[model samples]
Target chain A: MRFLSKALVITWKDALSEMRTKEVLSSVVVFALLVIVIFNFAFGASQEKMLLVAPGILWVTFTFAGMLSINRAFIPEKEQGCLEGLMVCPISREAIYIGKMLGSLLFMLIVEAIALPIFTFLFNLPVLSLQLVVVTVLATLGFVAVGTLFSALAVNTKAREMVLPILFLPIVVPLIISAVKASELALSRESWATLASWLGIMGAFDVIFLVVSFLVFAFVIEE
Target chain B: MGKSYLRNILSAVSFLLMAASLYMVFVYVPTEATMGIVQRIFYLMVPVAWLSLLSFLIVFIGSILYLRKKQSRWDVLARSSAEIGIIFTTLTLITGSLWARPVWGVWWTWEPRLTATLVLWFIYLAYFLARSLAAEEHRGATFAAVVGILGFVDVPIIGLATTLWRGIHPGALIFQGGLAPSMLLTLMVSLAAFTALYSLLLLQRISMKNDEIEIKRLLGLTAERHNTGDR
Candidate 1:
């Protein structure tokens, strides 16, 4: 219960800050929208003929948008030099990590939520099914699990902007593959049986990453 | 045996084993009937790929040990192993491509195993880049260690997903055949030789890292002395 509250407090603090500033969320949402628009231009006429590639494009947008948010996940703490202050808090470092990760996850999911409707309307793909939503959540969960950790790790590096994506994209390949496949099945309106394996893969990846990331969060948060 | 003597023996044995493996690869292993001599590349590629995973396992173990012990040596071991592992992985991809070009008739295809190997390569490449670019001291090492452990954990999952994706996507090439005993024997020997070589490379790299650290320490000491003397 203490751990839960500590993590929630951190999450609540981030939520309040974002509500006020709206810095990271606005930029990520815009970037994600831009990616969709660009993809439409590049593959507009062809997409109608072959909607199969739509899932790939959707995921590409989400991954890039998620990257943008993660890049700034630590900017507020970094600029204010408040991570050190957070470290000094009575709560465990794992709590701090959970807070930051949840904050990033929520921020990314909001962008994803906004992008989803636009994506479906623009691409005219059937992506609003329950299975797709679950896949999206699982995929994004695994994504931010590592993304939050890497962002904190990258924020301390020299070339942070470059380092974060390099560190992030490779580790999230499982999520990308599973998410894209599951989305493809859902978009095509395939039966649940066909999407089952992909869902299983995403679930396994998310659980493993979340647990592992939580365990090692202290190492990154500490000096 | 003394430490230097043991290292020397290890190095010599590693070289001899590699030579024997090469000879067997060229002379003993008959040309595969279907793919002809180009299939010979599989001997080298398979073992190198196996050892690459072994090297990654080393990095994973070393990273965990460093986190537990907070020792510089463990960090050195992990860093060196990651560097060498990436090299072997690169070789694996290239050789796999070489074989694929003739056998599968394409230089590259999104085959699941190859795709997984490619992703593994990217993860480790990112590992080295992150380490070098990170802040000095435990800041970088600790973060890289965390990434290392997480990345290792990610590999099998990614491999499975991609393998399953291939099933959904459907590709033209599918082969399930038994290997001859002679080929299997050669593969085992090649794997052993590659393991020996990996050990030698890791030891040498770690020693070099130690020397580099000593040099850095001495330089810092001199700079400190100069500052004190001027005061």
Candidate 2:
């Protein structure tokens, strides 16, 4: 109970801080929206063609925006030197890892929540479905799970911004592939059975990485 | 024999095996019934592919050992193996590309094995990049070990995911099947030669890393002595 509460508190702390400044949220949203617009212009994709390409565009934007947010995930703590203070606290390191992951996931979800409607409105695609939403949530959870871990790893590196993306993207290729596939099936209104395989992959990836990241976080964050 | 002598002998043996395989691939092995001499590139590509995967597996082991023991020697081993893995992986991709150009009729294709190798290449390149870019010197090994472990775990996932994605709409068509006895023999010899070569490169690189560390240690000691003497 103590561990759980402490993690929740840490998560709450992150959320409250973000709510106050809204720095990560605003930039992520703007960047995501810009990606959607650019993909629109770059591909010259029409509505009919958009459905075919929407899943790829959607994931690319989400991933890029997610990477952006993660690149800064530890910045405030790092800059203010509160990271050491937090490490010295009574809480277990695992709680800090979970808390940061939750905070990051929450921020990303907020960005996606805003971006999805706008993406739909512009592309005129039927992206606002229950299945699509489910797939999006599952995929984003897996992404943020790994992304948070890498962010911690990257922040302690010489060239943090460069370190994160190259290290991050290759590792999460599986997740992206699964997300794109599931999103494609959901958008096409395919049978639930077809989407189930992809969802299963996402679920398995989430479970494995959430546990792996948590276990490894204690090691990676040690000063 | 001394370690140096053994290493030199191993190096010599590797070269011999490689030269012998080259001759076997070119002359001893019969041309395939379908594709002619271009098929001989298979000998080069397959062995390199095998050795590269093995090299990465060595890195994974070395990394886990480093994390467990915190031994700088393990770190050296892991980094050197990664260096060798990248070299072999590059060879694998280039050879695969050459074979694909002639056989598959395209300069590039997203075949499962080919794409998976490309992803593995990126993962290890990232591994090297992460090693160099780690914020602190000692922390570099630990961070890289974590990535090394994760990157190896990712190999199967990538293989699975790429297969899944390609299942919906197929691309990058190519054929792989049974081989003749002579061809298999040539492949065996070539793989043995590449394995020997990997061993040679790994030993050389590891010793180089050790030497570099030794030099750094001596420099640090001399600087400390200068400071103490000045006081």
Candidate 2 recovers what fraction of true contacts?
Answer: 0.76
| CAPRI quality band, candidate 1 | high
lDDT per residue (tens digit) for residues A40-145 in model 2: 8887766778888889999999999988877667867887898899999999989998888888888888899999999889988788998889988998898888
TM-scores (chain A) of the candidates = 0.96, 0.97
Q: Write the per-residue lDDT of candidate 2 for residues B117-185, one digit (tens) a residue.
A: 999999998888877888777788888888888888778777778877788332332225677899999
- Itemize residue pairs with steric clashes in candidate 1: none
Candidate DockQ scores, in order: 0.85, 0.77
**Per-residue lDDT for B56-157 in model 1, tens only?**
998899999999899999999999999999999999999989988999889998988789899999988887877778779677788778878988888788
Candidate 2 lands at a TM-score of 0.93
The share of true interface contacts that also appear in candidate 1 amounts to 0.94
- Cα misplacement distance, residue B105 of candidate 1 (Å): 2.4
Question: Top model by DockQ, which number?
Answer: 1
